[model samples]
Target chain A: MKKLISTPYLLWMAVFIIVPLIMVAYFAVTTADGAFTFDNLAAVSQYANIFVRSIYLAAIATVICLVIAYPLVMILARIDVSFQSTVLMIVMLPMWMNFLLRTYAWMTLLGNNGLINMLFGLFGLGPFRMLNTQGAVVLGMVYNYLPFMILPLYNVIVKIDKSVIDAAHDLGCNNAGTFVKVILPLSVPGVMSGITMVFVPAISTFIISRMLGGGSNLLIGDLIEMQFLGNSYNPNLGAAISLVLMVIILLIMTLLNQFDDDEDRVLM
Target chain B: MKKCLSKLYLALVMLFLYAPIFVLIVFSFNTTKSRSVMSGFTFDWYVKLFHNELILSSLWNTIIVAVIASLGATILGAAAAVGISGMKRLPKTIVMQGTNIPIMNPEIVTGVSLMLLFVFFMARMNLEMGFVTLIIAHITFDVPYVILNVIPRFRQMDPNLYEAAQDLGCNGVSAFFKVVLPEIMPGIISGFLMSFTFSLDDFVVSYFTSGTTQTLPITIYSMTRRKVSPEINALSTIIFLVVVAVLVINNVIERRNLRKRGVVR
Candidate 1:
């Protein structure tokens, strides 16, 4: 009876989730006439630079998130226990609003005649060209995904026993030493999860790049999006690109999951 | 001094996080469409937002999809979770891992993959990709979340509760409805809300599947793409307010429930 109840869901998953993915794989290797070919896969190599740029920009953003989030999470962990939830709520409140609007807010702030330049004009500085740059794209990623990094790190670090820190100190380790050896190693799971969370979204984001990067700085996402939705209109190429992206992400996640094995073992 | 510095750091991080939102909210009331320069304040944009047919229609679509998709996912996921809890090792692992695919996969991949499926099938069926496809895609991504949320509740539930109800003269269906349902009610509610929020905020998957139909995010995307407008700012302000209201109400209800359960003083 219990197994019977799950049949509908299993059927739904097969139809929607598994089958669709299979179709992506199927379409990727096929031409417009449905003839099997590797040309679609070969076509993806032309966008090699965009692939590199996506990974590069995503890495930078992930690093930036880690750098920014770690100290903030440490501070968050140290605060009064009673106040933590409220502060955490405040941290996540922006996510409740539309992310597109949040990214649009950056567009206004970074535009040549936008708020930042307006503020610069007050100091008699010439308007700097900040918008439509790779910097702006990375900024958007870091701005949007910082919370993803913070949440996981906070969850892991907060659960760490207070006496653990005392033990490091008693063992004659200084503050920096304690952080490097004790806190850092202990926070590995959080760090790994945080990196995965931020990196995946940052890499996959098309909206942030399109809104902020203008015409010049296309990422892998933009390339894939163009093949289908944009003026380019090539589903075969799009499916090939999507398949490669899935494999890349899968590879990265497999690596991350390997790192998370210790945590999984503990849970089990 | 150290404590003070930590607090200052916290404040600055908070500032970085909120500055964009603050700017958005403030500019919503600006009289002009100019994104950079702020003129005198007016409620004109807010008023105009009501008259905008495209935005209004998209908002309606978003709400409808979220409601229906979440409802479907919750029911499907809760039932699957119950079933999975009774399964043996190999099948359980296979099903659970399958459940994680949507959750773990990038939204773009999920969106395009489903688009391929729908387009292929719809072409054969001679159906257009629009509302029905959008709902299916939403539910597809949403079910994993519901399953994840609900499965934990099943683990926490006493296994004998159904038997106890049956011993009290209830049949299998009645026992489940009376006892097991209440035990997992909180999980089901949370799963529903999570699915709803995900569906509401979703843009990427909806973009691929919706065809000509527009959800709020897709509408916002196109609006932003075409040009900057104060009306978008107005919409953002409204959305922000609505989100705040819902979250606050949810929090209050959660606290009240905890109090009733004597989990909190």
Candidate 2:
């Protein structure tokens, strides 16, 4: 009786989720005529710089987000309890807004003749090349994904037992020592989750790089997108690239999970 | 002094977050087409937004897809949760892991994989990609969220409630309606709303699968590639307002519920 209702969805997953992944793997290993080949996988190595750049930028963004969000979230956790929800709502409001629009907002702010440049010009500074650079792409990622990092960190930190911190203090630890020992260790799960959430989307984003990084900073996502929808038109190559991306993500998630004792919380 | 410094830091961060949104909202009222230069105040773009057929149609498409896909996911997810609740450890773990795939995988990968699936099958099946394919893609991504939401409610539910209802002379189905349904309604509602929001905001999967069917995000994507226009600013302002309204109302309702429960904090 319990099995009856779930059967439809289980079948749905088999067709949609499981089979489609198998299809990606299948296409990754085969050529256009359905003949088996390892060439597609080998072809992906040509874009080694792109993969590295994507990882580098994404890692930088994730680290920046962690740095910015950690202090802010800790402060937020210490705020007056009655006002916390309203403050959290404000923090999350941008996240609720359209992703494209948020990124587009930055485009306007960072353009050659943008608001920031206008402000700088008033102070006798020449316009800096802010947009269409790797820095802009990282900034976009940090801006868009900061809330993701904050929310998870806030969840874990705010829930940390107050007595733990107090006990550390009572046992001759200074404020900094207590934070480094008790608070930081307890927030590892949050940090792990926060890193994963920000890093995954940041690494895979094509739009941020396109809109902000312009033509120069092509990431792995752009490469895959080009093969499928853009001018490149090579589905097999796209599949191979995607397969590699999945493996990279799986590997990172595995590495992160090593720090997190709670297996269920690990996205993998 | 330290408290003052922390508050100042928080204020600066909040400013960074809100400054762009403020710029967009302010620019939406500008008479000129420029994103940066606000020449004069006007309602021209907001007026133009209403008359833009493409934008309106895409908005309509977004709504239709969000509503249908969310509803489908809610039903499918709720039922699956109920079913999975009674499963053995192995199958339950397998199903749960399968459900996590869409949530864990990058949107690009999910979009590519699904596009491949549809493209491969559609060639032989002779089915064109459009609204149906778009909804299927949305539902596929949305169901896992619903299951994640509903399963917790199932775990929280007292197992004896159904038996109690049956003992009081209700049939199994009727007992579910009377007892179990109300218990899990909050989870289902949250799941549906979450799915709806995700579908409404989704661009990547829809981009790959929609073919000719343009949703609002897809439309926004194309628009962003063009020169700056106040119409987009106007549209974003409206979207921002709608988000604010929804969140505020949800907050109020939650507060009211807490009050009713005599747990006012």
Candidate 3:
């Protein structure tokens, strides 16, 4: 009976997730010339610039998300429970809408003649070239991924004991001291999760870079996308790039996990 | 003093977070070719949007995909959740972690990998990519989310109830139906809704798998790439409103349930 109930899920997983991932691993090894060579792995060095740019941009976006999310999460944590739920709902509501629509909306706001530039013009600041820049790419990424950062932070922050803060105060720690030494140290888990969540997606995101950054700022995701759609028709190269990107992501996550472990040990 | 400053900062952060959505909603009702400002209020864009055959057809396609995929995912996820709950500790942990891998992986990776699989399959079987492929891809991603949502509820459920039912001479199937199903219904409903929303909103996976028949997001993507249209804004605004309404309704139902159980004031 249990097996009967579990069969469908097991079948779906085997056919879809496991099989597709195995295919990715297979394709990553094969060359465009139909030869099974490690040449695809060598192609990684040629696209070094794109990999660096993706990491740099993702790092910037992750930092911005951390900064923005920290205060918002702190506020949400300190608020009444009902208000916290409402704020959480509001934060998550954007996720429910179409991601493409959200990205397009960013375009409408940041384009040359878009609303933000128009507003600047009205304020006598004149139009600034906000679109098709690394700044714009980061802005779009931070906007899209802010909630991912906030939710985890909020989850961790809300669980933090208020008595801990009070105890810090009792120990002659100033507000800043308490925040830095106590609250921040305790919130490392949230910070790590938020960073992982933001950095991973931001690094791999193609649409935001394409739409908002135009043809100027190229990320690894854009390069992979170009291989498939733009000019290069090499599925092997695309697979290779994806595999490299996957490794970089895995490395970052492992580093973050190590950091988290060290922090946990210190706290303990 | 610090608290006051933090509160002010929080308000500004909220403004930043909501500003783009607010702009989108405002522009949806604007009566102009440009999306810059509100010239005048009009329903023209909404009317025009409703008239677009491609948009309407894509919307219909999206609805069908989301419904079917959500239903499929919910069934699979619920069964998995139930099965996992009945498992011993080590196997349960293994299954739980295995299911979570898809969720943790990037959407692009999932999208491209699935596209490659479909391409490989098509080459082998000569089958075309369309509804069937899209449904398969959607189910792939959607089931994990449902499993994540359902597993906790299953864990939290009292096990003695099942034993009690069994001791009363009911067989395992009858015991589960009478005992376990009722208790896990809320989790199942929430999982279904989560899966439905996810399938409805997904673009990347659908974009890869959806051959010629575009989903609503793909349709909007093509339209926006061509030209900026207030009709897109109108559609987005309507979709946003629907999500908000659903969320509020869900909250209300949850609150009512809490009140019924005397868990809240």
Candidate 4:
């Protein structure tokens, strides 16, 4: 029976994960004409514009999430424990709901006859084009991923000892100084995790761009999706792009993991 | 002064977090076609939503997919967790990290990769895309979550309990069934719930993999694209309520357990 149960797990890992990864690596190296070529790697250079846009958008979204989530985390950290849990629940509730539905809700709010434009109309302002703009894309990204940013930052912030803050106060560190020099440094792990969580997924998300940015904003995720389901049928090129994205994600995660270790040492 | 400002910030952030959902729920009862006005409330949309066969069938499809995929993922993940617990350290670390890849990787990457794999298989082997392919993709991603949940519980288990069960003359299989299974049941339940929620809410993977069948999310996407209809709003409201209820129930159970253990008053 032990063997029976264990064998299925071994088989699952082999067939689903390891084999597919091996196939992806093989596809990344091979050309469409079935010849072993470095052309796929070279092809990545030609798609430089897509890669840049992906990084740029992800960076912008990460900054936005950090800016918004930091204050919220600070507030949660200062609050009583019961209120902290309630706030955390409120933050997480949307995440638990269908992500697609949340995106759809944003679409509704941004559309021509949507709520925001309607408010503008009430102010005698004409129908403003807010839906397909870069702002809309950023807004959608922040909305969908804010919880991911908040939870981690909150975790680290809550773990910070109050005595440290009191000691900082005794040493004449004012509120702003203490926050910048002490709290921020201590919460580096949460910030790093927040950035990684938001940046990695935000860069690869095509749904927000497709729904909110209205086909104009072409993210790397959309590019990959296009290769499969859209007009482009080049799985080789798609694999190449995926490999590049995976590498970039690994680089970011490694940076964040180092900070995670630092945070652990601080806690200890 | 700083405290007041921080409190104000908290309120604003909470409002931003909730405003979209609040608007969606309220608009479900709007009488007008437009979403702007506070029109007279009506249950017409909810009535129409229930009568829509397409939406109903899609909901059913989503439920079926989530149930089957979550069940499969839970079984596989639990088995993998138990197996890994007994393995050597290096191999266990590698396998554990590998399992977490699905969770850490972007949904789009996973979706595109699986889509490409299916297309390649279809062209090469003359296979078709349908329920089986969707289930395979879901299980592939969801098993990692289950394994992550269950493995910690297994690690935390007292090894002596298993030895005592063995000493009581029970066979290994019977001992594991009676002892280990009971110990890790909560972890299994949590993992199952996590997988179920993930499978139900997944859009990108399902969108890429589903050839004919439309899940609830896909249907919602299609409807939202056509027009901002109250039917979609009603559907969202229903889903929101159900999710909140499930979470509340889970929280209550957890709190009760904590209280029983004297960890909380």
Candidate 5:
């Protein structure tokens, strides 16, 4: 009876998610001519630097997101209820503007002869170039992905019982000690989720790196895109690379769900 | 002193976030084509945006796709959620994991795989990729979000409410609409809004499956490869103001809720 109601969505899921994944795996292990070979998967070894660099940069971005989001979330948690929505509105408003427009705006700001450098020129600082560098790319990543980190962290911190902190003070603990021992531990789920949310998109991102880092740097996303869109035009190779990325992401998401499992247990 | 420090830090972060938006809005009205130095103000770009048929049409396309995809996903997802909510543990797990697979997957993978599927499907059917494929791709990805939102509301509702409605002379369909729908309407609305946001904001998936149909993001992307135009800034400024307006309206509604609850006036 239930299956009858679920039939349409089940079919949609099967056609869209299941079949497409199987096709990717099949493409990964086969030659373009429908013959069996693992060369597509083998070819990913050549772009090992791009893969490693992608993960490394994503990690750096995630760490930066954590650092910046923590204090901000703490302050957001301390705000009054009526004012909280207004603050959150500001945080989210930038996100609503087109993503490409946001990235393009950073190009103007971080461009060699951009506004910031022009301001520096007035102070006799002589325009230190900030554009088309790893720092620019990281700046873009953190700027774009920071809100994902903040929202999760803010929700978790906001839910921490105020009385628990009071009890810690009564037990002769300082604010720093109370935060470290009581608040931070309680926020593990949020931290885990925040890290995963930021890391996944950061690692997978091609746009920020492309716009900010220029051609000198390439991430896995760029490589995958090149296989399909660039002169390479290798669907099999793209599938293979996507397969590997999918596995890494699947593992990361497993960790995310592990954090959610605690929330689930509490709800149950 | 600590409170002041925290406030100062918040101000700095806010500046970081809005700096680009500031540039986007300012450059829209610039008399010059420069990105950095804004020379003077003009309404020419906004006028050009209206006159540009391609941009206007794509804006229309983007909104239509978002609306249809969100509505379709909500219906399919809400039904699926109701069914899944009544399932055994193992089946429920399997279905849920299946639903979430798309949500959990990298967007590029989803985009590429769907592109490949449509290509293959079209080759077999001797058809082409266009509007239908794009909408299907959107709904495919969007359904998971809707299901995730609605299922929680289903769980939170009083389980026996449906039974009570049936006891008071209602059939299954009527009982569902009368008792269950109102309870979960908030979730469904939020789910629809989420789907709309994802559909509208998406670049990769739309880029892959669009097949020559331009959305606003694609139009903006192509613009980036060429000379940076001030019209983009005008379009962005308009979008920014619209979003801010929406949030302000949302805030007013929330404030009214607080007043009714005796928390604020």
Candidate 6:
């Protein structure tokens, strides 16, 4: 009887979710001629630079987001609930504007003759190139993804029982000590979720790198886009790169999940 | 000193967050086209944006697709959440893990894989890619989000409420409508809104699957690839205002609901 209700959803998932993943795997292993080959999977070694760059840039962005978000979220958690909602709304409202437009806005600001450069000129630092660099890409990532980090951390931190901290304080722990031993450990799941949320999009982001980093600093996402689009038009290789990316992300998430679980056990 | 530092830090973060958006909005009203300089304010670009046929259609397309997709995902997801809530532990876990696949997977993989599915499937069926495929893909991704939103509400619900309704002589269907629906309404609403937000903001998945079909994001993307005409800035401003209005309305409703719940409790 329950199955009857879920049939629509299950069938939809089968056709869209399960089948699409299977298609990626299939394309990853096969040649364009319909013949099975390991060549597609093996091609990951060819684009090793792109893969490494993606991971490196994404990691830096994720770390930066975490650093920025943790303190902000701590303050947010301490603030009044109604105030927190307003702040959250402020953070999230920009997301309502099209993401591409948001990213594009950065381009105009960072353009050589754009807003930032013009400001720099007023400060006697004329025409410092900011656009089309690795830093710019990381900046774009951090700018776009900081909210994803903040929201989860805020949620988890707010849910931490006040008494948990009180207990640590009553045990003669200082504020820093209480935070380190009680609060930080309790917010591990949020940290993990934040990491996943930031890193996944950062690594796979094409538009940010393309717009801000320029085409010169291509990432795995651009490679995949190229394969499907006119540049290379090799779905097999794209699928292979995608397959490798999926596995790498899955492995990272698994490790993070284990770490979070371990933290939960220690907290208990 | 600590409070001052905290405020300073938050101010810097807010500056970082709002700077680009401020730039976007500022340029929208600039009399000159150059992003570098500010001239006397004019609403010319905004007027141009209104007349832009491509932007208008894509805006229409984006809204309709978001509404239909979120509504569909909510219904399907709410049902799935209910169904899974009833299942034994093993099956429930398996189903949940399956649902999480799309939610957790990197979006590039999801986009490319779905594009692959459509390309192959459409060729076999001799169907062209357009709104149907676009909407289908959006719904596919949106369902997982909706399901994720609703499932927690399902778990938190008191099972005895349904039984109590039954004991009060309400039939199963009526009992579900009266007891279960009200309890899970917040989740369903939030799920709907989240799905709407995602569908509206989506670029990658839409980019891959939208062959000649332009949603608002796709349109903005193409526009941004160029020098980014002020029309885009104008469009962004309009879209921003609309979303802010919607969010304000949502917030008011949510607070009212909370107050009502508080009184009842």
Report clash pairs, candidate 5.
Answer: none
Candidate 2 lDDT, B1-265, residue by residue in tens: 9899999999999999999989989999988877668899999998889999999999999999999999999999999999998899998999999999998899999999999999999989988789999999999999999999888898999999999999999998999899998999999999999999999999999998998999999999999999888788889899999999999999999888978889644
* Per-prediction TM-score to the true structure, in the order listed: 0.96, 0.98, 0.94, 0.92, 0.96, 0.96
Q: What TM-score would chain A of each candidate receive against the reference chain A?
A: 0.95, 0.97, 0.90, 0.90, 0.93, 0.95
Which tens-of-lDDT digit does each residue in A142-249 have in candidate 2? 999999899989998898999989999999999999999999988888899899899999999999999999999999999999999999899999999999999999
Give the fraction of reference interface contacts each candidate recovers: 0.81, 0.80, 0.63, 0.54, 0.73, 0.80
lDDT of 1 by residue, A1-268 (tens): 8789999999999999999999999999999889999999999999888988999999999999999999999998988986887788888898887789999999988998888898999999969998899999999999988888988898889988879999999999999999999998888888888898899989989999999999899988888889878999999999999899988888887877876655531110
- Model 6 accuracy (lDDT, Cα): 0.87
Task: Evaluate candidate 6 by giving its C-alpha RMSD to the native, one decimal.
Answer: 2.3
Per-residue lDDT of A83 in model 2: 89
Q: Provide per-model DockQ scores.
A: 0.82, 0.85, 0.64, 0.59, 0.78, 0.79
lDDT of 5 by residue, B79-130 (tens): 8988888889999999998987776677888888988888877988998877
lDDT tens per residue, model 3, B65-174: 99999999999899988887778899777776678767777778888788888988897898888999999899889898787777778778887989999999999999
Best by TM-score: 2
Worst 10-residue stretch by lDDT in candidate 5 chain A?
A259-268
What is candidate 4's CA lDDT for residue B152? 76
C-alpha positional error of residue B38 in candidate 5 after TM-score superposition, expressed in Å: 2.5
Worst lDDT 10-window in candidate 3 chain B: B95-104
Which residue segments of model 6 deviate by more than 4 Å? A262-268, B260-265
Of the candidates numbered 1 and 3, which has the greater TM-score value? Answer: 1
Give per-residue lDDT, candidate 6, residue B126: 88
Q: Considering lDDT, which of the candidate structures 2 and 5 is the better prediction for this target? A: 2
Q: How many collisions per candidate? A: 0, 0, 0, 0, 0, 0
User: What DockQ does predicted model 1 obtain?
Assistant: 0.82
**lDDT accuracy of residue B106 in candidate 3:** 77
Model 1 earns a TM-score of: 0.96
CA shift of A173, model 1, Å: 3.8
Question: How good is model 2 by TM-score?
Answer: 0.98
